[model samples]
Target: MKQIQRFFLVSLTALLLTVFTGTWPTIFKAVARSSNPVYVAQSLNDLAPILQQLPTSVRDRLTTFISGDELYRQGDAEGAAAFYRQVKPDFEVSDTQILEPIYEAEALSPESLADWQQAQLALDDDDEAGAIEALQSLVDREPAFIPAPVQLAELLMEEDEEDEAIAVLEEAATLHPYSTEIIMAQVETLADEKEYLEASIAAREFALLNLDHPQAPEFQALADEYFEKFSKRRRRRSIFGAIGNLAAGILTGDRVPWESWNSAVETAELVELMLASESEFGASLAAEYREQLPLVEDPDVVDYVTQLGLEVAQLMGRDFDYEFYVVQDSVMNAFALPGGKIFVNSGLILGANSQAELAGVLAHEAAHSVLSHGIQSFFRDDMLSQFADEVPLGEFATGLLSLQYSRNQERQADILGTRVLATAGYAADGLRNFMATLVAMTESAPPEYLSSHPNSESRVAYLEEMIQRNGYNRYALEGVDKHLAIQAKLS
Candidate 1:
């Protein structure tokens, strides 16, 4: 037992000697086996001097780089730029040699080029701050390289680091105002960020200065268009300031006002009580029963609706491929979907007498598409989803009593469509006459679908008033069925 104890003491002494002598391979292997607090505390104490020796600027740069990298990785480009620029580099080891006295002696060597290439690689890897730091090092070594600042500015712009990008570009532009590409890029960025007024001023300045250049004419034309659009938008906003407040609750992200919510409830209750429930569709049935629905594939029928659609769009001053689809349902309906998709029910077609009358209804729905009214109307209602079992149907169909667009919205579309149809070389008579026919139908055989879009005697008269004022409109719409070659054989 005494021999065993002596042998253990000798082995313990040897281990302590190995640890104290800094033979870390053996010590570390042993440490890999246990958590020893004394060694950890001693190790940290030894690092204190090393930590103190690091330059404050280098420390700051490292901290900032790490934090900014986190932000950049998270897709917060603007935020990352903010953190990155806080770095104040401390590189006291730079050469004491001044280049002014010995220009070629101090000119950038291949080593400097290698550094530039390194920065470029970091940029290519999507590490903007890393690239900036690398490029900045090259810039410090060779202070006159134009590529460094310009490239940094461009990368910053792409990352939406607008303010920082602008600061860099502005300085570069001061030196090279003739670079149209750089100037235009900055202007585009400003415009996309909704700094339109500033962009317009910059565009005007560029246009005026470059008037003698070949591209100046193009720039001037674009500047003039921007000026006109912004000018008109400003005037419109000024005119509708009061109306903006009244309806803004529904248009913006703010909470819906109590008054608006109450109005919605009241309107819904009114619709629930008074709206027809698909029972008032007899006139539509008669119109369809007397005449077999015109085939959608009928060349004459397609040609007729397309011509009217084009005529209507022209009047509205919108350039769109106007199309009319025959849904074939004997429902008194017409709808405008996104991207000029217009559907007119065969029932609405047979219900009308004159080609002009049918043209009016088609034109009105076309106006809805052009003015984006249908999209806006959708945003205002039906933001709900309900289903029963596997089938989907509304408890109350929407068309029966849509609170007809506010009279103002209706009047706006009417005046706009009237002008469009008249300008497109189509007679406004179709629009007016159709409204009048609908009025007559309203009195004689009111279709359930017509309730929400109740015929206004005043509206038909209003179209006539516009025609008399605009003076017997004369425009012709030209359309050809480019798809007639593709109609599948029907039995």
Candidate 2:
């Protein structure tokens, strides 16, 4: 068994290397003939990072090569032939490096290219109807021609046919699941229609589809934004549902079950409900997390941490009870679980320079809970359940390591966290300073902050904007001596 596993690993590695070094046709054939083609496809897709880091010309050539293979698989023999013939003459490939100047290669066949160019010309001429007709015809002829569907969908939107546009994009997504443009259009259109649940799901699927793409971080940020918006909508619905349940109970002369609403459920209450067969999900999972994660033992330290968290929560006008735990780990990390369970790593606490700094971090985690990030994490439509079940925990961990908040959610957190810090009588600079430090930390070692957060520069800039726009006091609270005392306890 061990030998077989070792052989599989070696073969997969070789196949991945061939995907980079060999000609397009050879790599395509190899992937097509593989026992587990999906695995082969993913392994090659992992080359996105390396492909992105290459020179622009090289990346373009690689894209052309892949496009050629895609055309071939779609039965466009002439297009495939053109790409194959052009590869060697345009550039000399020596040891996986392009050795000479290369002419631009065609990713589309001559015939299709001419049609697509004509459609573009029509659109430029303010001939929306003509552009739509041409692009629609082009897509009808070649459903796999990704550009046609994207253009057609855009033109459809211009004609105030958003539903039809979404349909066109959806079909294109099915055919060209890896087409970034198509997936993006579908998600944006869904969002524009306030179909946030569908938009969030689409964004997440796109992120998973192109996990290593150069724009993957952007995709994740989009997903986070969608999920956050969906959560807000869900919260509103839950509030209404609770109200309805209350009215129904009064009329029926029965006790209202407030927990029946789709609001966040407390772990203890959920466990009891499950024991009584009143909950759908197992309470054991929640208990497992609470029991397995190591917690700080010192009463004074725990009390102080809880006090600080409550102060921030109160500042945000959150009336619900919040539980804060200090995890006895060395990683500079913190996270919020469902139902207001927030965990702060001891390392994070020790590394803080001031109470305000610590407060900023705490406030940010609180925002995740407040924003319903944990709830969104488990949300699945029937379409996604099968895919979700197939993914291994280890594979899932990679996505989580980048941190789960979308770019929008992160921005919201940064904005709200700054407000919470200021409202709680702390300097607003605390979060900004922490983010700046994190940006630097990313260069030396992977910190927990980066694990599920967006790129630091954007985060820091937006945070600074919020602080300046709000005119929050940057030098309000230091609590340096008090922070040092907390550090002393841990030391």
Candidate 3:
């Protein structure tokens, strides 16, 4: 008996060694066919020592299968399905019984199942509002249940609550980042609303996240088609905007505010004002403003901000000589002038938790300069007319400070800034996270920054969606240590 047992132990050890060395077919089949499959599945962790011996691809598939099996046993059929689908190509078990969970319907609790049924009943009765409310409640309680939010968003869309519907889908996407169904629903909704840019982004994201999916090529093609549509639409809007601005300027008798301002101070003169000479109109204005405001003269702090700003500005496709200055104010605020002159408040630098956050602000301000938003605002508002025949430097500076961007312009800057941030290799979510910080900071009263740059929950949601859709590297360099050092210097 002892000799027989020793032989059996030796055989088992050899079998495990073979399995670890890429000879897993036989053992896998045996495990699948075992009468006590649950026991075998639960004991998968015991093979952890040998798992590392397998190739990374094979190891990952095996681990994914194990995770799916665990979820299946825990009655999370939908969750298990997602995992199983990912590894289905690799794990082809011959035993039907072993793979039963993959094909099983999702198991919901009694309360959830009843609620789902009630929602269906409401839909059948033509009570759309009731159905939507029920579905909303279901999703609120069981966010992981993927179907509820999708159906709820559809209902909300039918109700003409397009923004709210998009918000719902965005929240669902956040909960199930890997759910192809959820992403598809989001894309379709956005397309229905003619939000071609966002739709194209969503479709491209699906392709990126599910590279091996058979439909990836189809989605990629769809993304291109939508982007083409978006481009055409943008061109049309630009022409219309130009015509509208012309008519407005003619009617208001301020036909060339921006052109006049530009002629007053050439771009080169503005650069000189920011860099070397203090005799130019813009430079002298900047000097006067410095006298009124507390300016940070710390060379290290100023150089750090300037270099970081340059890094982001370089990728903005603009040839402007971008310059950054630090202010000693304690208000969380930053702004950009007509040229590439960006001012950063020390309070903003201190408030930022990481270098990425500060970089986000710089990128946003640079985008404003690149997009010529300030000039456009000045033109549209006929800001120059508010001044005398010769606009005083102080009044001009004050006008620049008081420039308020429209919601559309702010969104444009946000989108461009996020792209620049990601391209510059900072965490892509830097701006989104900064917005979240601002939201938290606004519990008492809105900050000075929020006054100029609007803050809303939806803005943060859309930013997150953009980041996820574009597959931007949010885990890239955050520069926390460097940020802390700078903060300490300011302190």
Candidate 4:
């Protein structure tokens, strides 16, 4: 009985030691030697999931680590440490790597090692003013630091300080001109402000400057298209809307579209956009505007729409001193002005549910600005007197723009509108939903959007495809939820 007890105790001690400091292969061999089926199955289950995602190189490294860990488990701490120290793989400077922890440990080799990290910490601290100041300095000094200037621009822009943000970006642009980011920032900001007559020309000039480069063709086309579109919209409004509004006013003593020549009717509309956007440094000029039409004026509705308007306005560029006028009309009419001025009819204001419907309006107006519709309108009407009665555009030039856009221009604005809403973290789907509702509503009632927009269905469909292609998650209003509730206090 004493011999049996001693033998059993010896067997238990050996089993426990085997479990402590050996590789899996060795441990399993020992277990197999002991004929233990359950331990092998348990080990396989533990490793299977982790092994599945491993690439070949990772799997190789993992095999070594697993071996070391197993050895440690079996009680050979020194041996385990030796194996772990030997297991790491060497990555060369140019090695294209996956996003594993090991790979991220060695990405972009930029200067200013701690500056960006510190900047991020400052940003997360919610001291946006301080964050902007610090980041602006870092960007000015390094210029090569991508994250700092971009974040700085975004932060300042959000705080309604476009001029400062634009200045910071301009400095960054000097270092990274060909970088898509810098170029887009400079050109896109100008476009957003309705500096189009100039902006379009500038966009073209930028393309010309880079003509020998890869992006030249696309940029050139965008610039030219913007210029020509503005020229034509101005021309079209001059021709059709000119006598149309004046005659309507004369024909009906009602407050007509254009009260008198005090405005030029066509050109003044464009000019109005410019004047409105004047306060917002980068958001002024003869840009296009579009938004839902309100049937009546309510301060509560105006407040809601203005909040949304300001949100989208900042996304287009920066410098947003804008106003939301509650026009008491029901034609679903809204328009944009240069210098951050927005005119919203009561009809349009009350009609918007989400920001997209408003975005649709804003983007359209932005397109107008980008194309320089106002300045070009002056050119078109030749109030400078370049042509006669048929408004200079007449039957001949109308064939070019045709008082409606070719599918390309309409699609471009819709695509851009979708992008604008998405960038602002607004619900882009709201535009699509608004379109569907409008279409359905139009079936039952008169459709104001179509008479003006003409391509509502296609625009909505395109927006849908865009959101899917870009994989934009619907907007998260958690940041604005409280604001929305407080505004709800108005009602």
Candidate 5:
């Protein structure tokens, strides 16, 4: 009877696939709502043909559900819960009957529950040490129990044992990487202790690792805030140190060259190396492209873009001699070279609805230069050694053109670019609104700019939040009339 029932279910599933390839959601719903869900789950292997006909996203969700069902039947409820959590937010199975196991697994067992209650009682009685002791023992016994460690960390923090509290949350995060609660706790603690860099890194890593999570943008924004704080603090220290060095030099009758500063010296060396000869990497490659690519010669058009770019570039906190040029291409594209050479396609100018939008694009490219993303990319892939060895300019240019910025790098640019845009008195949402335009354009065909710089709704949301959180004045400047005049010159 069992064999016959399994065969019948598989045959029915295959028939449904044959008849309803276009109605995949209906078919999956029917299967999930089957009266004998366990039997349907068991017969999933025999429905391989049907699964193959489904779209990849749907197929993946179904596969995850099937794996979770199998684990649940095998008595590993905890393991099943882990799998269910991934698909639970967006994919529902029989009104989340399939996801209920996660809630069940999250509950404490009788022994752990009693211990938790005791800790709460101690806290209520103002016995902080007792609560801490109880929570520590409970967490040690059941490391997977998330709340125990959280409570213990809170107690430790109240007792002014910040290091131990951070350690406790860190261990908990290692054990439960999926727990946003634990990670956020850790980030807040680090930020409270003024460990801005560490907090920024932690938040950024979480967002990068879990891009699909609903809270990813929030984490990314937090990372931006902390990183900005860190940068400001470092800048303050540098200024004071520079003043001290100047005074000492005057007293000792010895002057240090400004170019001898580590960052300036390193940047100067890189710039010199890149522009050393026609056969060298950066400048040679840029020159080769200039010969092939049609460029705008109208002084007005070029000057307009160069002036706007320089306006935003000054606010980027980098003192490089920034330069901008316009390419006679109908593709919405712009790119920055290793130093400060930026090329903007004519189409990008016509694509902008306002001057703020154009400034936003230029600022983003300038941020790439200011952040030294191109140079870092070369060093990261050890291409600098090749450049030193005098690799053929064509081959080196190929590598440079094909460089894809990591998601983290892209987010950093967006954050910094937005900051400079607002500081330059342009609308703070200029970059974000431009990204939304790209997102809309993607529905038809993706823009060339997006090919290199991926844009998404989450990225837009984060920029919006960053603007609002910092109280940036988005209504300050639109410059639509000025932008139209520039567009007219190109036309």
Candidate 6:
């Protein structure tokens, strides 16, 4: 049992490393990637989600350490060790390859670092005012010091001075428009204050700056929430006017076909509401889940998966900017969020007999998004149309992704996805082979893939019949060399 667990753990680690590093053999290469301001900026943005999972104090100090190089260069290992000891004494700066470029992109001058240290000391001594003063002075002297304003804003917010905190954030945002910290702080504060208009504007700007960021979808959700709220406010006023008209006998004519009229109006309203926020809301929920999952960082695997998804998407007859990612979970599962984002577990990859099997799974999930089964399965019309219009997106996101669809929806996705494989020139037997594999695994714990996608003799029979009826090329493409290479690396 211990050996089994250890094997799984090592496999998971290998998959996790695949994301940030290139191939497995190159993982220990001593060279850092070429660094420029643009690369550093993007790298820091990518690191935001990981850093945010840590305790706030530790995250702050770690950010400072990454931005300043004096500690290691000046042989202050003792001092660095002492500083890290406060958080996790066992922590070492061994990931210097990752940190080198960030250090090279340091914009914080030595004086600013000194002020930051002083502010930290003041805060440690319980001199709140002194810390604020020092941080404020640092911000003033070095407007480009991204952390100073953030620290100052945090201090202000702690004292219940939210307005001042927002002011500091706004100034910081102007100075560093691409800084995720500043934009998030300002947007969240404005949002909490019900300043939805301003918040929406800031969130939009943030989205444009960080389109590929995990936080980008969250900002989209925020903007949609604000828009929904603002729209509903106007809707309520219009409702009142309609009520007045009804009271005045202005709309007294009775509808002969009440069902037809109601259905049309309801459908229109649902369409409008969906147009208002569903895609962004769904994408945001997926983004949040992504932060919780350890993602594979290998560009090669990511590109291969994404390229396949895009091809399947093209075959779906829709133009979706599909995003594919690998999750470092042992569960053999693949699921799609509301948007085009799809996640496949590493276990699924290693378990697949061929790339055809993997492509079949991806095509199936992509079909769910293309067919809007996720949206239809999760939300009821009236539930989504409350005058408040405050959809509990976060509450439903993970649940919705895990929710099983109706038999009809499942069948449609299966047929369509199988057809997509054929259309994309992959073996039509991919889905059939994969489902057979799932059925064979029923003796042990069932794979999570079978939870949402129930496998049965009938389903496989239908796939076979469909393949015959359509005369799909069952032997076109079975797998690729890259898939075998990836499996070897993971092993």
The prediction achieving the highest TM-score against the true structure is 5
Q: List, residue by residue over 1-491, the lDDT tens digit for candidate 6.
A: 77555544544543443332211211101111112111112233534543443344434544443322234234554554343333222112221211111111146678877788899899999998999999998878777656677779888888888889878877666545556777788787777766565566566556643557888888777766775664565456444543443443424543334533443344344434444554564566667777778998876667767887777767764355677888877788888876677888877877664456678889888877766566555442333344232234444454465457766557657766887788776667777767766765566577777887775546766676667655776645544333443543343
- Model 1's TM-score against the true structure: 0.35
lDDT of 5 at 73: 56
Better of 1 and 2 by lDDT: 2
Provide the overall lDDT of each model, using Cα atoms, as 2-decimal numbers.
Answer: 0.47, 0.59, 0.65, 0.48, 0.65, 0.60
Query: On residues 173-239, what C-alpha lDDT tens digit does candidate 5 reach at each position?
Result: 6545456887799889989888776676667656744557999889889977886776566445445
Error of 2 at 105 (Å): 42
Candidate 4 similarity to native, TM-score: 0.38
How do the residues 178-215 of candidate 1 rate in per-residue lDDT, one tens digit apiece?
A: 45665576566656665554455445445544456787
Report the lDDT tens digits of candidate 3 across residue range 430-454.
7876776677657667778999888
lDDT tens digits, residues 181-251, model 4? 65566566656554455446445434633446788777777677666555555556554655565665667
Q: Output the better candidate (2/3) by lDDT.
A: 3
Better by TM-score, candidate 5 or 3 = 5
Clash statistics: count for each candidate: 6, 7, 0, 43, 0, 5
TM-score of each: 0.35, 0.46, 0.46, 0.38, 0.47, 0.45
By TM-score, is 2 or 4 better?
A: 2
Error of 3 at 88 (Å): 30
Stretches of model 2 off by over 4 angstroms after superposition: 1-286, 380-403
Give the clashing residue pairs of candidate 5, or none. Answer: none
Error of 2 at 179 (Å): 32
Give the per-residue Cα lDDT of candidate 6 at 465: 62
lDDT-best of 3 and 4? 3
